[model samples]
Target: MRIVEEPFGKGVVVKPIGRLDSTTAPAAEQTIRDALTRSGHRLLLDMAELDYVSSAGLRVVLAAAKQSTAANGRFIVCELRPQVRQVFELSGFTRIITIVDKRADAEL
Candidate 1:
């Protein structure tokens, strides 16, 4: 997986392309943690190009959200592909994480 990060208002928009699985989750987790720290925990995950996610990926996302919440920061995920959305829903992430349909809604 490839992670693209850029400044978005007061936060950062992180786009992850390709599959996020056990093989990729470690790197993704590090990159996301770095972005969160650099952006003061305000993160927006733009999953438009993400095609797949596994249990490892879910752990990464959950960790990020937990960290952001602990720091009193904002973390939002938007533009999920249908398959990816299903995975998140089935994993019970939809209730705990803030997910939006548009990046605009997630903008800081």
Candidate 2:
């Protein structure tokens, strides 16, 4: 996976493209953690271009969410493709994480 970051106000938006599997999940996780640490918490993950994800990828998302919450910051996932949406649902992550259908909706 390739991670592109954009800054918006107090938050940083991370856009990851390509497959997020075991091999790439660690990089993705580190990228997000670095962004959150550097930007001081608030983050938005734009997953529109992501074509695939594994459980490892999901773990990274979960970790980021937890860390953000613990730090009193917000972490949100937006623009998930249908396939990835199903994975989130199946894993019951849809209930734990804030997921929006559009990037505009993700802006708080």
Candidate 3:
């Protein structure tokens, strides 16, 4: 999997371009952690190009969200494709995390 990181005035946008399975989740999580440490957790995960996510992937995302909360910053996941959205909804992740239809809708 590939991840692209973009830093903006307010936060960083993490765009995962491939599957987020167990093999890829760890690296993604590490990248996210590094970004958080540097930027204080104002993070936006742009899942527009992500194709898949496993339970391990979800854990990484959850951890990032928790880190953001602990840092008193924002974590917004936006532009989830239908399949990924379904997985999130079925796992009830959508209920616990802040998700939006677009980047503009996210509270960035």
Candidate 4:
């Protein structure tokens, strides 16, 4: 997976490309954690290019959300692919994380 970061205000927009499974979750998680540590509050994850996400990927996302809240920041995810969306919905992750159809809607 490749992590691309773009800054917005004092926050950052993180885009992950490729599959985020057991093999890639660690790297992706680390990348996101690093971004969050420096990003301050508004961390928007744009998953437009992510083709697949496994349970490990979900754990990473959950951790990031919890960490953001713990630090009094905002965490948002946008543009989930159909399969990934189904996984999230079935797992009830939608209730815990802020998900929007557009990246612009991911308000800090």
lDDT of 4 by residue, 42-82 (tens): 79999999999989999999999999999999999999999
**TM-scores of all predicted structures:** 0.97, 0.96, 0.94, 0.96
- Tens-place lDDT digits, model 2, residues 1-108: 688999965799999999999999998899999999987789999999999988999999999999999999988899989889999999999999999888788763
lDDT of 3 at 30: 98
lDDT leader: 1
Give the least accurate 10-residue stretch of model 3, judged by summed lDDT.
Answer: 99-108
Of the two candidates 2 and 3, the one with more favorable lDDT, higher being better, is: 2
User: Tens digits of per-residue lDDT for model 1 on 1-108?
Assistant: 799999997999999999999999999999999999999999999999999999999999999999999999999999989988999999999999999999988755
Better of 1 and 4 by TM-score: 1
Question: Which of the predicted structures, 1 or 2, would earn the higher lDDT when compared with the native?
Answer: 1
What alpha-carbon RMSD in Å does predicted model 4 have with respect to the real structure?
Answer: 0.9
In terms of TM-score, how similar is model 3 to the real structure?
0.94
State residue 30's C-alpha deviation in candidate 2, in Å.
Answer: 0.8
Score residue 11 of candidate 4 by CA lDDT. Answer: 92
Assess candidate 2 and give its TM-score to the true structure: 0.96
Clashing pairs in 2: none
Each prediction's Cα lDDT score? Answer: 0.94, 0.90, 0.88, 0.91
